[model samples]
Target: VCVFAVKVGFQGKEFAESFEVGLALAVGMTPQLLPAITSVVLAAGAKVMSRHQVIVKQLLAIENLGSMTVLCSDKTGTLTEGIIQLHDTLGIEGSPSERVQELAFYNAFFQTGFANPIDRAIRDSREFPTSDIEKLDEIPYDFIRKRLSVRIRRNGDSLLITKGALAHVLECCSTVETADGSLADLGPYREAIDSRFIELSNAGLRVLGLAIRNVDTPHLHKEDETGMTLVGFLVFADPPKADARETIEQLRDLGVGLKVITGDNRAVAESISKRVGIMSPVIVTGTDLRQLSDEALFQRAREADIFAEVEPNQKEQIILALKKGGQIVGYLGDGINDASALHAADVGISVSSAVDVAREAAQVVLLKQDLGILVQGVREGRKTLANTLKYVFFAIAANFGYMFSLAVASVFMPFEPLLAHQILLVNLLADFPAMSLATDSVDPEQIHRPRRWDVGYVVRFMMSFGFASSIFDFMTFGAIYYIFGGDKPELFQTGWFVESTLAGLMILMVIRTQRPFLLSKPGALFLFAVLSITLITIWIPYSPFSEKLGFVTPPPMLMVIALGVTFLYGVGMEIVKALFYRYLAHR
Candidate 1:
């Protein structure tokens, strides 16, 4: 409202000017809202002031987030829905019927102490016949016993229903009947049922044993919950994410190994890993990790793709071990349990809806909570790091030429290679575009490839290429000085003009990683524009302005030579760079 009022008051003013005034008044009148507005305004400031806060608290957080190399995460709510569902049932005994299944489902539905995935599955199974099914005494689920039992009244008769781990249920049952109405001794079937249970468990499926017993009279409660006939086992699981398998394959293509660090049972973790394209035949559990020394642990981590029953502390230990082996680890997590490990990784990335501490501790936050985002983030980070190194490479190279030309001219000639203004202009003009492009380059192929930092390689290339280019500029400047007249003041003017032109070309060469002859591109065009403007200023005539800066018009032949030498120098530098890059590639 205030902005509108101010804009209406200054209707005749230019749009931009009115906007500026209106903005000022609007902010000035609302002092209480200043802090919030100030945050928004300063949020877009340089990294050092905003995201890259220098305070110790923020610095430590950012460092931890950026340094994540391995991620340990919880399975429930992190990878799966934390909700289990029974999608199908296979009956092995006694004429499989929906009536029998509904009875088992009803018993499971009403007996619950916790809102676990298994319980939810029973409740979601569809409405049962409550009129015929009367509640009775119940034995709730126990982690150790791994079973539950209930007594109920149905159709004027009392019955007992029991469900539990298949192996435990089979141990107490003496006989089993098939759905085809055939009976078999429980002794021979025990091994077969146990083997099937192991198979299902290894695939991360939850298994449940079902059984029922009939009584002569209806009863609300009963004892002797044991010695019931075993019906069959039911398997349940939370389905895998649709893209998990494909994402794992993509990570493998980029040379990033996929490891499942989960607090689930070993069988469960192994199952999920196999389903998601992890081919590792072995799994390492927290118990196994606890028994190994640090060296053994690292060796194991290098080989294993699934770590199960991993506690929070063990997550950090695994990450540290991976880092010690010189691997750059990226930790992806979403729970508070992951915070410690997240803090210990090379790149800590969190899903958008992750716990507060996890998100705050992460360097990168994925707006979408998907594994694919982590893949994308890694690619972008690598490109950013590469471009930054390139900037450092070229900046040092250009500086080498500048330093060499100045040093050689001071010793062997009457004048320096460049004046103060010329040096300042070249530094500003050359650096801006180079830095901009360095920060902005996007390479599509980079995401599909893995890269490791090699400090030695960077230093070697920088020194060799930078020194060679500097020497060339030095020799070229010396030749110009000698040809014009070594000690004459007139030659000083020619030297300055020639050296400045050479410096511009040297900068142009540094900017182009490929061919330098192509100056029609936007980057090269901007470079030339700035160079021309600076050179024109040096020649501009004025009693106060030009004279004070030692301006002097040059001979027409000097201008031609300056332009010609610059073109030739650019061509030579490009050839040198190409050869150098080729040699490095082959090596």
Candidate 2:
């Protein structure tokens, strides 16, 4: 109103004429409740997502979560229980032996960085007399080396003990120690050892190689890592959680793709991935990734599901490559190694038990490691998006129709179709029903796939429904001016106001879903609000407030004709909706 007054003063237009024209123009514009409606809807969705054990740290991430096309998740803790137990120890000949277990126990017992589950498994298995064993030095684990080494003294002789990924350890060994305590050249048995590793990994055993070397010096250097005797293989088993396969299937059904990224061997990762039903069969290793350029990596990243033996930096690179392939990537991890990848992803997701670095980098966190909870969050996000778009489409359509009616009517009549104050009253009364749209139920079919805002789709939907609504408004104008003799301003405003309110409320029922209105019932609050607002709007002009609001009661015959026009408008919109969705499906 203030802006219009300023325009009138600046343009030197007459106050009476400008004020009346401004009111007519304002009434034709879209409703002013969009920001408030969006806030209410998003807050309600946040509350629903909270109940599913998913915490949304960034509220805007909720929308991105819905649009996520690829989920790159770590397998150990996120997909499994992360509880590893020492299952067996194998000699260099692939035979189970007690001597290998004893060597593994000492290697795990003496040294420490942070506590590891694999170390805990071995330490808790049996008590070793460490009083006779003295620690000399240690090399902590590194992702590139994939191993940790410790030098210790037993019986006044210094020996260096190393354990890590089986293949990595094999490259460092020159000889093998058999169960009989004899050393043989590791060259002849290298092929057999690799075959044995594959067999064990395929069986889902997390396999590691242990090696030791007798050194005269008290210290061990990185150069000393070579010329070591490969002692044996330590086998650990971490079972997948019971619900993992079901979770994978559920996500697949929702049009979300899953990929596994881990530092484990390709055989082990592949065996586990197949069991959990991951789709892409190609595996890319960190070494294989390094040899490829960024363009090559991007092409492979699209078809590869298992990224094995990936370093933290490689993990970040893989995420970037996937994004380049045009996917909205979501990374889930709990270890400090995952922080870089988490930050690189479009939406970083973590669990409640994740390390501080990982948690801080994540935008969304699952309070539990349950994939079911994440699925629920996705559904809720799509629901919020679907309903928000519904309101926009309905508003644009109904407003366009009301505006078109006023533009056409003004050319034939000298008076304003509606007063400025009456237009505001009608807008206020109509919006009371829209507040309930946020909490309304969304159809399962609408949420079966990922949903995102498409400007082209919105424009098409608005024009198709908006123009159909205009046809009905023109029909109502004909009834008021020709049939009921309501050519005067007071009678025309009252008649058109009642008809416009009914049309907006009735059109909401059609646009809120793709299905017919009878099959998709709205929530009780929405239904009650729409019904109550409709009744009150129809009864307003007959009330004592009618004269003060510049309205007059229409005749009984005119009321009957308004109902007929509204009914036909609804039927016409239903037909347009069917054709519009059909057009959308083909597109």
Candidate 3:
């Protein structure tokens, strides 16, 4: 046996060389030591075996993941990748393409780092001004100013390029040109520009305004570049994920609500939401959220699907509010900013390539950073949980039938219904095969539209079936005992005959109803064979051991009575189950 096992171990060397070595060590050990060595080696191998352990761990993780009804994410890395790019530019008013490009170029060159997505986008554009320009001074980007400015000499004329937030740039501009080449007052044009900015932003585009002014040809300084002509606006943002639209639709089918929580402007977030099919009438901003109390925030969070300019702290607050309302929240993130909410979520999922801190906090890490895996993971989780529950249900019901029959026989008869070993054998034969096979059975419909298992449903079904089976088991044993006793009731002993017969009947009942009649083809031939074997075992008295176990050779009249009892018990159970199902349907 050891030599054969060692050969098989060599074939499995790719899986784990250590396992092969351990198996070989066991084969060479002393007889007593061999068993211990084999047991330890097998135990160690079980840990590394992918088949059952992977399924078990994945199922547990997925169950927790699917329970999440709310999700919180950081705006920068989570949504926009903290990178911005230009999509399309609409020159409202009479601003020329040349003017817009020149203003964008100044903003792009003046910004220091390529880290800011907007700056990189502007620098990448092909039409920006390059020739006949000499830089004089610059005012770097600032959080407070929310803008960048630079001074340059072009054709001996001092040009000031000031680019900043749309509202701030509009405020500094005294006048602007319309697209039709007419001069327009900044007041009315400001509203139109703001509206256009919103329109673009909601489509998932980031918008920045650019303005320039002609200053006196003095040695230009960074401070002198403010209060300039509104040159034009620049738009930049990361393109949406290729399958983001489809992924969002899939989530909707699974009854998961999708929301965009971003630090970008509200318009950009709204635009992305519309493109991705997350339509919600209400759009909320971080500034707006700050004004509301916690109670109001919670209510609004449920009602709103688009949030913009949202800070990291606000993400955590939103998750807490959703959870407080009895919703399970799952957070997906890959950034430090998302840490707080991720930690608080029921299940935190991070991509494998995510930051160490984020991965450490998450319960599940996707091998591939794809949203489709979430759907598949949830289905597998549901299947494993259902299979485990099915095993538990049958085990409990079978034990109840066995114990009920034994109790009745002990009270009314001279012999014990079944010995401990016989009872153990019946359970081993019936339960091991049936329950193990059930775990592998597939319900295709369940995979498509899986739902979270309700504990209440399992309890209700088990109790209904278990109670019916127990009653039937008791009646079958009682009828057999009474009938075989004949007119000389004290002389006749048939406890073993009734007990073994009841055990065979239980095996039949369990197998027949394993799958719903509507769902599975009835295996009547197999059931008949089981019943025939049971009959022969009790009546054929060829073996002395059978007689010792209290088997009785019953006459034809007693056989007829046993058959009738089985039929009546089965009919009664079907009627009860049908009525219970009807009540449940109505409720």
Best candidate (score: lDDT) = 2
Candidate 3: segments with Cα more than 4 A from true spot: 1-59, 66-84, 88-193, 208-234, 237-249, 367-369, 396-414, 434-439, 442-458, 486-515, 521-581, 584-587
- lDDT per residue as tens, model 2, 1-587: 64346546655556876577566567547566778888788888888998998888887787778888888998886567688889888898888877777777887887777677888898877766788888898888888788888888899888889999988888789999977889999989899888889899998788999999887775667778889999899999888888889998888888888889998888889888877776458899888999998899999899898899889899999999999988888898888889999899988999998888889999999998777788888888888887777778777877766666665555445566666677667677768778899899989998898877778887787788877887888778877877756547788888888888888888988888899887997988889999999899889989988999888988887777777888888888889989988876336
Local error of candidate 1 at 353, Å?
2.4
Residue 327 of model 1 has an lDDT of 77
Per-model TM values vs. the true structure = 0.64, 0.91, 0.61
Backbone clashes in model 3 = 15
Best by TM-score: 2
Ranking by lDDT: 2, 1, 3
State the lDDT of candidate 3 residue by residue for 325-378, as single tens digits.
777677777655667777787777676666777777777666545565655554
Q: Per-residue lDDT tens digits of candidate 1, residues 243-353?
A: 777875766666676567876667877777677676664789888999999999989987777787676778889888888888777677766667888888776767666
Candidate 1: residue 474 lDDT (0-100): 63
lDDT preference between candidates 1 and 3, better one: 1
Among all windows of 10 consecutive residues in model 1, the one with the lowest summed lDDT is 51-60
**Which of candidates 1 and 3 is the stronger one according to TM-score?**
1
Give the TM-score (vs. native) of candidate 1: 0.64
Query: Which portions of model 1 show Cα errors greater than 4 Å?
Result: 1-194, 202-235, 280-282, 443-448, 451-453, 488-548, 583-587
